[model samples]
Target: MPKDYSLLSELADIFKGKAVPAKAEPGEVAIINLVDMTPLGIAYEALRTFAADTKTLSPYLLEAGDVLVASKGTQHKVAVFEGQEFPVVASANITVLRPKEGTNGHYLKFFLDSEEGRRQLKAADHGRAVMNINTKELSSIKIPNIQPVKQSYMAQRYVQGLADYKRKLARANQEWEKIQADIERQLFL
Candidate 1:
């Protein structure tokens, strides 16, 4: 199948994350720091929270369908923010990608996490003590121009597949444990 490529800038609003230095005591807002990024997704429960004044954070506050990409790291993990109970914002070491209406944020994340997508993003890597991806490079990166509906469908399947895989892996582990227990019992007998 022929693939169409579109610049990321054409599909999303690319911008850097906020640089709030200190977190207020008894934090009121959650920050998606680079440390919170994982291979699967952002660790919402483990995010650093700060008692930020909402008014000042309004611009940087993440929307429900916004996508996040770790900017300063060897692996630029990507995730779609599904919104949180408390207001959430991206940290300095992260980049916030607000998808245009034509693009699906989940699909964008799925593509960015794909092997080909990672290769494209690696072009932005400037070798140094710590690797970094600038907004300009990210904006210029080309993305597969799949229609929004198709992207949505693909994203759903990708998410469902991950869930199914995790469930099966856990069940396999349980089965293995049971077999191991029986083997130990037989050996003792």
Candidate 2:
């Protein structure tokens, strides 16, 4: 039999104070936009350039396995960061949730994207036209308990699949470009 994971609220008490950093401009740090995120994962250019003066920005830095939740915009957009050189400077409308001890980032992300999680978000949300959940509410949101090892495995598999898909897509695009180039050469010459 599988172990019963505790409610997300059970683990909330262990987290420290939430951090809300200043927004990052172009060329400062890699930025994650709504368009850059998908159900499976984030897009290649999801992390774009930041402004030169972004160093002055607040605690907007993200680690390899940090969880990024869409705070102000659409209800369901969320993403997790993979390893990269520059840290991610997320948008103001987004909330970055860093897991505390005993909580796994991958498990939190997957749980939040689930049907139960969506319902909880919907219930916690205020505002009539544009539904939104603040950092406080988001922090209070419940998540199921999962083993850290299992979470790591799930994250690894998801990332691997996405990476493979991106590589294949890149190869296909290159092939198409070459075919187009050949046709243009024959026609022009």
lDDT digits (tens) for residues 76-177 of candidate 2: 777776767765656666667666676666777778888888887777677677757655666667665567787778878877887899899899999999
Residue pairs in collision within model 2: 8-143, 25-51, 26-50, 26-51, 27-49, 27-50, 27-51, 28-50, 28-51
TM-score of each candidate structure, all chains considered together: 0.84, 0.71
Task: Report the number of clashing residue pairs per model.
Answer: 0, 9
What is every candidate's alpha-carbon RMSD to the true fold?
Answer: 2.9, 4.3
Which number leads on TM-score? 1
State the weakest 10-residue window (summed lDDT) of model 1: 20-29
Query: lDDT values of the candidates?
Result: 0.84, 0.66
The superposed Cα distance between candidate 1 and the true structure at residue 64, in angstroms, equals: 1.9
Looking at model 1, how many pairs of residues clash? 0
